[model samples]
Target: MSKDTIKCKYIFEEDYNPLYVNGAQGGINSLGEIIINFYLERNALPKSQTFSVENGKISKENIDKVEPKDLKNSFVRVFQNGVVMNYQTAKEVHKWLGKHIESLEQIIDEQKDKK
Candidate 1:
């Protein structure tokens, strides 16, 4: 499939300093299953990862320090019901870093708003 099939969106605001936000939703067709992936990027590279939704909650760790080889291994594990996405290329893996950070920022913002 072409990379163009992936959809991404971003938003930015300027209040004293620039604040940026973005999110993406995509999927890969594998073994008759369409795995839908979600991501958010604020001001940096997006994280390449996926979450397992169970009972309306994410069922995976917010992974960090993931190497390309580790990603490949993870994907293999996931394919066999053992692990998760195996990121092969730097480009593919880097895509998720920003989203992870953005997600964290969003959580912090929500907490602040609640307080």
Candidate 2:
């Protein structure tokens, strides 16, 4: 058995921004496409803040105390962007991610054994 492959030159994008995402959340849209929204999980912002201003000699102070109040939320997920793909593409991505995850786990195990 033999296999044939094609080699092509790849071009790099001049302007690109790399973002760090911790989690993903999404579902199938109306068009029956898989939608995966990547997001960065972080602490929720405070509702409001209070600042204390005191008249010392000229200004209030070197560092004025600003207290954030009414912070009741635990965490928040800020969704940056999402990717939409068909069923076939979804399966391809699933296989690709599984392979990469397995490789990463093996690398981690190797590091642990070295230590």
Candidate 3:
């Protein structure tokens, strides 16, 4: 599929839980970016996992409070393919990438069958 034609979906904070907590902000943005990059690197269309953030403008101060390391760790979960890859890690992410590619291939096959 063309890169430009790849489908991407985003689930913002409003769709799940707020990213900010008592004075500490979560790493949703960084996590989201990581997920998108993960899909792009493997040539799979990006699909956002469900999440929610509160309404209102997120300030620089709040964003600054987010921990980058924590966000990266959290993003690792997306790659766990529910099999031997039960934990989030670079290896699991690669496995997930493979799964996504297979899924896309299946989709294409199904489309062809319908024709």
Candidate 4:
């Protein structure tokens, strides 16, 4: 498989909609960049809103605040066969991707040694 053909399941807010996204990996040096960029792009929205007020305006100012971005809900679940992690724990799950890649490499090396 080409490096650019990494397939991953991206879950939107509250697991409402799941989309299959393909990101291009810049070889082994750029293993996790794809998912990291995806997370940033997905969650980098304007969370805070602004309002205007007039002089001594005493109207009902009950502004509704938007909920925080659910990082856990919006994350890449897997990256090809090298990365397999849960999406609930965003940071920890992505962190495990490195270890999983290393483990896969080690297993591949061991298999090659046996042959």
TM-score between candidate 4 and the true structure? 0.26
Top-lDDT candidate index: 2
Stretches of candidate 2 off by over 4 Å are: 1-5, 11-13, 53-69, 72-74
lDDT of 4 by residue, 1-115 (tens): 6576767997667746544545533222333332332211233343554455668664543244433345335544344333332345556765788899999999999999999
Q: Model 3 misses residue 36 by how many Å?
A: 12
* Model 4 error, position 43 (Å): 30
Q: Once model 4 is optimally superposed onto the true structure by TM-score, how far is the C-alpha of residue 61 displaced, in angstroms? A: 68
Please provide, for model 3 over 23-93, each residue's C-alpha lDDT reduced to its tens digit, 9 standing for 90 to 100: 21122243332222121112232233333345764333343344452443343222311112222554568
Backbone clashes in model 3, listed as residue pairs: 13-52, 13-53, 14-53, 16-51, 16-52, 17-52
Residue-pair clashes per candidate, as listed?
A: 16, 0, 6, 0
Candidate 1 Cα errors over 4 Å, as ranges: 1-88
Q: How many angstroms is residue 31 displaced in model 1 relative to the true structure, after the best TM-score fit?
A: 34
Local accuracy of candidate 2 as per-residue lDDT tens digits, 1-114: 899999999887887677899999999999999999999999877554444455743443222222243345367899888899999999999999999999999999999999
Q: After superposition, how far is residue 76 of candidate 3 from its true place, in Å?
A: 30
Candidate 3 TM-score over all chains jointly: 0.25
Ranked candidates (TM-score, high to low) = 2, 4, 3, 1
Q: Which 10-residue window in model 1 sums to the lowest lDDT?
A: 75-84
TM-score of each: 0.23, 0.72, 0.25, 0.26
